[model samples]
Target: MKLIGVLLFSACVVIATAVQQKDSELTAYKESFSPLNYLNRYKDAAAVRQYMGLVETGKMLSRDDIFSLFNPCHRQQMIALFETLYGATDFDTFFKTAVWARDRTNPRQFLYAFSVAILHREDCRGIKLPPQYEITPHVFLTTDVVRRAYQAKMTRTPTVIPMKFTGSVNNPEQRVAYFGEDIGLNSHHAHWHMDFPFWWKQDYGAVKDRKGELFFYMHHQAVARFDAERLSNDLPVVQPLEWDSPIVEGFAPGASYENGQEFPMRPDNMQFADLPFLTVQDMKLYEGRIRDAVSSGFVRTADGRLVSLNSTYGINCLGEVVESSTHSVNPVYYGQLHNDGHVLLSKVTDPKQRYGVPPGVMEHFETATRDPAFFRLHKHVDNLFKLHKDLLPPYDLSELEFPGVRVEAVKVLGTCKASTPNQLITYFDESHIDLGNAVDTSTYKEMVDIKAVVSRLNHEPFKYVITVNSKRSANAIVRIYLGPKYNWFGQKVSLDVSRWGFIELDRFPVKHTVITRNSDQSTVTIPEPKSYPEMMSEVQRAMRGEVEFTYDSHYRHCGLPHRLLLPKGKPEGMDFKLYVVITDFDKDVVSSDVTVDELNHISSLGYCGVLDGKIPDGRPMGFPFDRRIPNEEQFFTPNMKVLDLVIKNVRQKPME
Candidate 1:
């Protein structure tokens, strides 16, 4: 026993020493890994040149061939690089490859490629990525803030600065700018793209179950949520962008690149002209073909087979084709409608780049939503999916009915003692983000913290008390949704129009007569993101085996920010409707490998699909609601109920 104990102690000491050495090496490597290096401030040009020469000698794309991911060839080049990174045998090798790729890849492309690689690679799992805003503060924070942070770091005096919402009250569209320009909201968008990258292939070993359908549902939800915000701000719903007409709303993002380059602005009434490759006529052609496919109830595959659009996989197929992912049935005939639309809108101000200006915010996913045009563009995209859905057969009375269950009533209870029942509350809150990582302080020996506080819309915690009368003990899936009570014209919203405006609130399983659900436990959103320092500390502990870590938990950061789940309601209380539906749980097709306990943990299985697994819900993503309503009276079954309510913005002082 003594000999065994001695051997074990010596072995542990050796292993600990090796782990300490590797950890030290990683800390050093992170200095070069700083996303700010992409700005060229701390870039090593000789290292980049050497790396590019080696890659070119191997017959891969030259540096010039890969600049913007908007280009098809550039996207392909990035995929190749990502595959190389994923193929690494261990974490050490992956780290080395990432360091090499980081310096040579274009700054814009590096952001996507590196993030996607981190999400897909097993060795990189559980490793927390620094938030993109911290990586490129220039894009999220105003240039003035970034410049001041640098100035402060040089002077050895750090300070906290407050970041106000971008636009003024003059522009009516700017009413919801706070929602669109939110740091957490934009991070959610960027992170979702990383999970379901358009370039992903099945050969990569991880099949994104219903990748196409998920692509459709996620964006659809975003557009619907945006419409709800618009109605809250007393603005009309977003109008679809027209291909032939001039864009009326102008947008200046008030953001810049690290090289001191301001994002180009689009003037009011800017015309859409033909670029060298894509033209307005081409866009129209793509739209016409897509419409024809949906109308005919079939889409032609690449090999010339007509696939029916009426099957269980119909929506999924259409999603892939519309998003133009690698899973698209016919890329040549269908064309890249969604992607090219972004390209056309992005370059309207500087189509040729003859003025030597960067493209507008529309060009990148991270910064895209800051502009009003993004919602308009997605509204058009949603209509395409809606066209297909409009033709689907309405849910029969049998399918809609939950025979043994009836929802008697539903009410929301706020966390505050003075709060009223059935009334959800919203307010403005401020949170600080560390900008210490944004500034390159390699030359300085001492570490200094630079912080910025951002004001954003938030809501008080609330719970749902759902009264149910069940004839017998049985299981069912409960779904909750919220929407405006009136339309843009102040008329009572009809079922048809209100259908598109409803955003899903929560989805869960129930087996009793009474159900209580907390807002923090919502399935549609994850918890608010942790601070930069907090995330770093947690990741280090996970690496040292001090606590449990899983890829699913890591993915929690990719969902909608819990704080922004409810739109900013009127101070006097805005009228809204809450719709609850209970469906047979036996019919819900969840993967066998996923245990109920595993799912009980934080899961955004609705907005963001399960990583490396199937979506928990068996029904089409927006079941019962995905299709058009045949008759409003007949649509309300015993198992479903709608409650009238109001969401009030309880005014309070700034959080800071």
Candidate 2:
């Protein structure tokens, strides 16, 4: 027994030593060649010479081989090839190998792909990421913004400057750009695509649990939020993009590439042209087919079989077909309407590429929201989804109600000095992002302090105190949602129209024993940013043996940034409705062995379902609000309560 114990101790020491050595090597590599600097540099290179040489040998490269190529332009082709070659392999082995290979590559494409793989890795849940690769910065400011900041510093130019307005300042449509152009919001949209990619694991089993349903819900929620922001700005709701109609609300992104090339700005009243890949007639045909499927209650599959669209799975199947993911039942007949629409609109200015004009901002996820046309395009997509949803039956009372549970009362408590009960406050705050780490300080000492000032919406932290009356001590899941009470004309919107507009604030299971929740404690919101100073202090404390190294298990790579918790409201305050619902946890809970840490790691659950586990809730993604209320006037009953809330926009005073 003593000999075996000694051997076990020796094995443990060896494993610990190996882990320490690996960490040391990673730190050394980061210090020698920062990934951020490499991403900035290689994105401009025309080709990766090393990778091209490997390709010339005529030896087939493995999926891992594709990750070693250091060229941003070749990423899409490489990813496509990777899926084709290794789709049937074990996902865990494929992911770890890709991550290992990513460390050796110096391109932004490899890093982006690796980062996404890490986030989606089912086995790597709750694993702590290195501070440099932490996703907070990426969530707060997108990859494009980071690249632009690094470029600005390298070129000795100002990071941000006010651009002259192309359209009349008084035009109400101009407000969409302000919210749409926000870096954080756009970053969230881009990350959602990465989280639930349309083309991942084509031959492999489904990577995510409900990719098609998430595709429908995430975009639907985005359009709803966009409408909320539009109404807050006193602008009319966004109109769907009709292919034949002229796009009058032209957008100038005021964006530049790392190479200092500026993106083309669409002129006022610019008309879309037929693209080489997709034409107006093709779009009309696709739309017609999808509408026919919705109206006729069936769609033709790839193998020429009619599939019903009436069941719950039917909508999901239809979503996959319309979004045209690789998992689509039939891509040939259904076609990729949503994605193709974005592609066609992106090339509206240079459909044939005759003038050497690159695709517009709509072409890339990172720059899509920078264009106002994106909202119009998505509004059209949402309208199509709504058309299908309208055909579904409304939720019955049994589906909407919870047994023996009641939300007695609920109120929000704000942290600001003048904050009132049930009132949330949004204000503009400037954040200075340092680019010194990505730039060479030795060459230009003056550029070390170079920073980009970004003005964005911020809200004071608030807490939710809900009083629930339960007969038993069973667990209950609390769902909180917010939506604008008034429509574009300042008139109260019908419950039928407003049901789809509700934005999920948070969803968590609470022991009937514990009821109150602080906003800072929300699992949906992005974890608070850890400042450099605070991180250094923690490091010092650990070095002095005063405290052990710690990781915030609550902070997950997939979540909405906490900085954008609240939308920007009007100066006087915007009238909104906060709805709270308490449902029986037994019914809502899915049977899973996922640990508490793993559960917390699913920060994007409200928007993007859990990675590998069953979606936490038993009900549909958007439960009560997903379908129409049996009776619109009877939405607020004993189990659910709608409370009036106001979000006031506070302007910061200029420094003297």
Candidate 3:
């Protein structure tokens, strides 16, 4: 019996020693294997040093050159070169190879360019990554919280403002920053630009289909969503930034870039100024030219040739020109309206480079939404697309009607006890995010979990139940949308006006038999393991054999965060309308030649488009909402209706 006890003690000691060794090895691996370690070597390269010196001297890189580096116009070439050298491999292998061959002119630009390539790669599709690692890192890395934390670790000083929200209540606009300037939303915007880049690839295979149309639809939808949030908070919808007027709503981001440099704040009521490259007159001139193109039904190319805007491709071409992509009908003639406007507004406070201030939030995708001007700017841009869309004939009943199908009733039910049928619940919930994951910690002996409690708008999970009347079990495409029932001044908005504000909630094929779906299951909404902690918990559980790790299954490279599924509503329940429409699935699916696996996993298909280079839906990007309603009103018959609903804000206690 004594020998048996001695043997058990010896076995326990051996196991404990092995566990320690394994953990030590893992710590070493993490320290050595970070992307920062590889990327830091290029910071001192001659090209990067030269660019840094130029930036320090207040020499701005040309708009085209800046975007080219940030988004790398030769992305396909970079990827192909990596694959040729390293062979097809996982993201870690491919990313490392690409980094080695990348232009070392700017470390930040290289980081943004390569990370974007990895996120959009077919092999890396649906890989579940921490939000910081995914796309939000671009924003988070620049935050005072993250910067201070990293600096403190290096100097052994206590972190100042380690994890606090940045903007203050100096103005009403600042109050809305909690929603408008969310890291996740900013990340989504940044990712969208990476997905639908302005720089066109020489190889057609590298370019996404309907790129121009998606540009219009995506930003248009953002404006719609912004309007919904505004109405919920008792604010009017965003208005266009008048070219001749002084901008009243000023922004103080109070945030920093990845290099710990704070973005210069634009004072209140700042006016647009003339720059050496672009002037107020130049902007007005470009606007007039674009307006002329819209009215004349054609745009003049750089070579003085007229390009007709009357065909199906007309809107696409117009979108390219207005957004001023490389594929624009004529970049020099049409002018870079959208891009230059952002640059000009971003530098309004220092247009002549007098202050030596870097461009404001509007200068880059990751920082753009932090400014109130961004929404107003996009509102104006959306109007440009609307002008062209209004010219197109409204959809007839035959174009919209789904034969032999009708939606009998539509209802939304919430999971929480406080939730009422047909009413969704939203609230200001505080989430504790660990910024440690975002910071580079190669030199640290132990990983620091710097936590910050940020207040954000969240909604209780809900389900949609739809009663369908159909004779056969055919597949039907379900499109769900949301819009305010009334305008800010308490007047019912016309369908024509409300149509522009409609935000797509979900789009998926439902069998005629299946009528119920949880909000978590919505194609437009991602399911929760919603935060870094939640994701890490699952990984821990899988390691301990408590749960099977379905990382690949849950990987969604593109989609809005699940927490942002609902717009923030008022405490007293804001009234809104939920619109549901069913179309024949057979007619909606687009035929494509490019092959990709698990196309169904590409959630948010309505907004994000298909990964296989095909527009998933056959109709116009927004379909029924893309065009005006028919005057006959036959299309709105019992098949689809605006169900009245309320969104109430609930107070949520912080989790322990």
Candidate 4:
């Protein structure tokens, strides 16, 4: 008996020790390894110095340059592989937490940029890294190095802008990014970080078989390769990533700023369908691996009649953290508005541009940055379709306000097919994309079937309080329409409660509760017209009155004066009409309402405007100052204090 007892005690002790060891390893893995670390090694001391010297010479990273890093395969898919692995497991706080935090961080979040700079410069044809640059290829994709980058980005003080960094550290770029501790999430005093895009961009490397490189495709060769063997052996796997858990100081759940951008529901900017790893198979390569990643959950068919018992990546509406209210997936907002080409610019190359324009606000033009965070969020968004269909039961499409808004698959925005209004990419799939293309919304007449999204739906309409506010009062007969487009003269917007009553409803009873018809309230009566224009004028007065408040209130003005502008130099001027289809990624089309008259009357404002003057021809003018013949003896840069004096006195006050 005593011997048996000793054996039992020994077994228990051994088990406990093993558990402790495993826990420690997991903890260390989460805390130490960060994408920032990977960047420094790729950058190294010498590479950083050279990059900075170039920057001082007015050289900046171009969109093509950063995108080039993802070519070939190995470099592009490295981080992508890790993100997949992070999602494979069930309730792994370390992985999910990191993904959510870093993805929202700005694209150029310095620490995140370190990795981008490394991968971007790796295959540069323009300039070769100096011979003295002593970076080993190992630096390109080392988990350990990534850990170091995170530490640096977190601990640095006094802020880490590149110019200042160049003067202090040998690798100013890396140092500034790695030691960007001062960069907080937002100004909320929240203890979080701010950076997301580049971290998402590192998911894949370029595909090639160079002497010093691996020639593997990301979805299949790299990720699915390990994934397949692990499933066969019945064991867990570890994945490499760019970074994790990027506590963005400003991004917290329920933040008044966070509107429709909830986690896991919609992909970033991707309203239709979460674009998965478009395999080469669709284009003639192998990409099904993405569809067959992990068999963790289940899904139902598109028609909602069939259900697959086993789908990969289980469903969790809420994350592991008890406080979080969701864990579906988010859509990717890839800087391009496929909803009909009206993006901030031709190529929203700036990573900063990915974020929402603060709903009713506008940010600086220079503030625009490409948001890679949207891509990461989109991965999860795609998963939501599967999870909702298979594991978690989603509401009926008919009951959804925008009924099946996400079911449609449109052209995944890749190439800029529109050189002019007439020239647009009509169709995009694996084989033929980037061609001048076009599409009609549907077989139906109205555009309602195109990309419209509502919150919920019900079989019958319900009571709703209608509030109409307009800036102009002409005894307006608020003519709402049954169709999605504006009624008759584009003068009013009418929503049908009979078809979309649940949309206005805030919440319904738990479980499945049927809404009955109260006989007395059978028909909700909307009688005479109200003076909506007066109400709207109150709000507009406040906006335009305080120049600082709602300066450029055009795009949001659905009531009146929010017109689409035509591209300049078009032979037939200002005829901007967009043909929209939920499934058609190509949005440029024709419409009668967006006539030349309306186009000519569109509001004009700059992405970044100065209080001094209004934007000219769709572009914002800088603090208006005359071209200066600076005294060679004088000192200061274009944005220096001395320039302010030159502009104030030398240049007249600009007017609207």
Candidate 5:
């Protein structure tokens, strides 16, 4: 009996040691991911000297140069680093390996390196990352707002800073700044890029299926939605930037970098000029070749061969060429038009850098949409995709018709009973965001929970009640879109002009005859992201077997914010059309290799494709509207219906 008791005690001691070790590993991993903990490499003598040397040698990373994904040297280095970290046997090993590299490498680059490894490493699957907004608050918040938050933290007085409109009323374009400068929208854009990085290679894991196509579709949707918002503000649709003309709209982002450097401003009426490395002629040449390919219905391959553009894969191929990804048929011929265009606009104000100004907001996806010019630049990019789409034959009647489906009636009912039918009520809502993790409070005796309140456009919970008669019990895809009823001149927008402006509201699969979908559950939107401490606590609980671990809804952060799903409408109500289409799910479903866990994590498949899986929908992105609409009657089928709706901005007390 005495021997047995000693044995049991020894076994218990071993188990406890193992548990303590596991807990330590988990804590280390969580700490490494803290965005605020990013080491200041500029302050390190060795790091500063190395960076200076690279810049003087003209070898530093530049957005204007060929994208790093295609740069052989850069690609190899990144791939090797990612593979090393990903090959770790366990989470503890992975955490230790990352810490070793993170301490030795450039801090900014290590963040990217670490994130990429986490995404592809199967061991790291289902692990929740803290909301990036808290990691790099400067990217998502104004300079003044962030500085004020820091002051509040130091003074031990937490305050909620209101996000005021960035520009004055003198600039008519500023009217829609609320939409362009939205925190959630910008965060979505930033997270989307991280999820589907342009540098992602086949070696990382599975290739991003139709990535090039997604690039075009995502940006295309953003610009289209912006145009609709502009219409709501009584402003004209965005005008594409002319290569030779001067940009009249000046942008003052008022946002700073983590290192306290402000993003450069571009004064109004700045003229485009030739830089030492790039010229106007180069841009024209690239555009001319692309247009020529679209007009001729074929693209020139690298080996001097012609590939037909009249196939299912045409858009994907075009997207690769336009984005100038490594998959492009001929990089030399196509050039890096899309990437270079961003660089040009970002540096136009300081083309020669004589003023020592850094690149503008256009250089970063997170801050780009804050400027009105971003829409104009993207409008130009959309035009290129339109050129290809216009040349293709319109989607025929047979392609759109759902033989067994007929939409008899559709109505949108808001949560508020007093609201009129087929009308959405929009209002300003204030949200308090904790900024504690955004600053380094390690020096303080007590942790402070700084906060900020931002006012954003939100709509009352609404549901779409559609009455459809199905000949048989079969699954179907319901696609919803919203567009302004009239053009800039108050004239009813013709189908040809309005088709491009339609903003997809939601896309989901349904089987019932009477289909009802709540606005809060939109497939294209994501719930409010949890702060660092909140996510950390949940992760810790799951690790200790205190709660069930799941990544079903929180896995993908690259989604439109649920709050801004509806655009802010005029006070009196803005006329808009709610278009719904029920299509055969059989023709739309794509076979995916993802596991059941990953399969359940898809929330924003409409805008931000599934993580490491097929795009899910087999139809060409943008479906019926992707092609030209010859006539309204011909375009309408038994499965499609258009309902008249109004969006009214309900007045609410402004948060002081």
Candidate 6:
């Protein structure tokens, strides 16, 4: 009898193992990497062309003929495969150029520029590279080569800039200059959640500089007081609507309108006005719920038009009160940018002060470099907006808040070193793009050219300078620079220069001049900058709610889904309080997407007999029919009252 029992148990174990393996396919997909597989799959010439979004042109080329677009980590991973199947190119010139630009903050432009440089084979020695000089794609001889080159260009250190080499450093041919402008319109979707601590990963040639995701860990722990809460995957999480042990609180005046007697605004006005109290309350709850969802892992799409979500992503206001909107919250980034590469802004305010001049609002305040990235994943919201642009009502985004608006911005870069005060370029002109202007205008949603206020190189804030005149900026005041010239870790430097008329300066590029432009177009005017506010005077620790102000509408888009943080100058050991708030917009807007079927998924086979996780019960939103087996109570933190409430009010589960 004992032998038969043992045999039966062994049989059950094998069956359980097979079932578990099949269910664990997702992790396997992430690890599915192979050189042989790549070569074998691309052996067919037509297939290679298809992979690159190109048609077959009957070309014969070795696997090396193709280019790659991976990073150092990936390169290291596929070392054997790369060496065995690919030919090499001298990437020294490319590497030097990449670091130079990445040291700044125009990484996007750098990536764009790198693409142009290689395709045209241009000499990368001089500045003033014009936008017109063109090149030929025939140099590579086959679509596969061009496609391979493109991939290789992205992944390799010495990326191929947009310009082609014409045998001279003075002039280069522009190859595939529009490549960046032509790719997926939904690319913005991926920006919010691409992973974290990008300092080591950036390449390509750019003019501006940017900080990475790593800052939050040290910075928050220092400035924002809190117990160690491991980010849901070491990635920047989104901000929840209602404050609950938050790191920052966002506050701002809701949108003001020019009187709703107008037509388009009227539709929304009435919809908002007629909204039932309960309906509006539910909307607010949804907004907070969405915030929880996004911060936890939900992403937005580019055209998804999660318009309300944009409220959480950035600091902007739209409503009935109207006029001079300012932000109670601020974000940390390189700076702002014009629609085109026209201009760049930098940080200037003191760490304690609030950012955003009146009439503007706080937009997004988190990095997407995490396991579940909001930057990259959030594009679904935008994409949805784009796909159904017609069905949605039109609204003017023309005068909406721009991107890269820092609370205490100061320009510490340019030919004009520390000769001026820490000058912060505040106003914006417009945002332009390859498609046309920043706004669509077809609907009220017009995309404007909001430049990175404090970025210059590809993507960084390596060094900043302050100059006086818009042109021939030869002076500066304070000089500030991040990153270590000697080693890894953050550094801060303070300098003085009363005569330069500037506020601060960042480290880097002792050459090159800083030029300013005044729409006034009269003689260049002097800058009279405002001082950082008092509320930001001695920030120690504030709840996330205390720090930021938010506004929302019927659209689920308005919830606070971006993590908010205080731009602490010395985040090494500061402690600040944070708050999260939940409010109902006037109306409840139903999601255009299909209704979500409350899914109750389970993992693991019967090997362990029973499994882990909260076995929900009672069913309020229709779920958890008291199906407890084992390992239940692990999902919610004991500190979370909402889960406790849900378990008590919604489910029949007893409060722990």
Native-referenced Cα lDDT, model 3: 0.65
Tell me the tens digit of each residue's lDDT in model 1 across 1-656. 33333332222222212220122223445454532233232223343344445465654444332245677766766766666566555555555556555545655565566667767766444445656676657678876778778877988887887776676788888889888899888888878878888777887787788888888888899998888888888888888898987787988777777556788778788888787789889989998999999999999999999999986569999999988888899999999899888888888987776787766788777888888888888888889999999898988898899888899988898887677898888998888888875576566646677898898889988899999988977777889999899988889966876887788999887767799999988888977766656655655565566755444334554788898889888888899999999987766646555444555653787788876666767788888888989689889999999998899887783232
- Root-mean-square deviation of every model: 6.8, 8.2, 8.6, 29.4, 8.0, 29.2
Give the CA lDDT, 0 to 100, for residue 552 in model 4: 25
lDDT of all predictions: 0.75, 0.62, 0.65, 0.20, 0.73, 0.19
Ranking by TM-score: 1, 5, 3, 2, 4, 6
Comparison by TM-score, 3 against 6, better one: 3
1-656 in candidate 3: lDDT tens per residue? Answer: 33332322222222212221222222322333423234333322333333334444644332223332222233433333322222323435444444333322233344444445545556554444455422234354346566566676777554434344455665766556776777667767766776676764534245477777777887888888888888877788888887888888877777665545567788777888898878989889999999999988889988889988866557788888988787887888778889887887888988898866766778787778767888888899999888888888787777778777878888898887656799888776666655554455555667555555566777788889899888666777788898888999999977887888988888777665447877776666554335555655655565566865443533444566677778887888888889898887777667543122333556666666754456656677676887776563555855575689998876772222
Report the Cα lDDT for residue 72, model 4.
26
Count steric clashes of candidate 2: 0
The residue ranges of model 2 lying beyond 4 angstroms of the native Cα positions read 1-54, 57-76, 80-106, 121-171, 202-206, 437-447, 528-548, 551-555, 592-601, 653-656
Q: What's the CA error at residue 542 for candidate 5, in Å? A: 5.5
Candidate 4 residue lDDT tens string, 216-264: 0010111221222222122222122111233111111111111122111
lDDT comparison, 4 vs 5, better candidate: 5
Error of 3 at 540 (Å): 8.9
**Per-candidate TM vs. native?**
0.88, 0.79, 0.81, 0.19, 0.86, 0.18
* TM-score of decoy 6: 0.18
lDDT agreement of model 5 with the native: 0.73
Residue pairs clashing, model 1: none
Per TM-score, the best of the predicted structures is: 1
lDDT of 4: 0.20
Q: lDDT of model 4 at residue 108?
A: 21
Reference-based TM-score, model 1: 0.88
**Candidate number with greatest lDDT:** 1
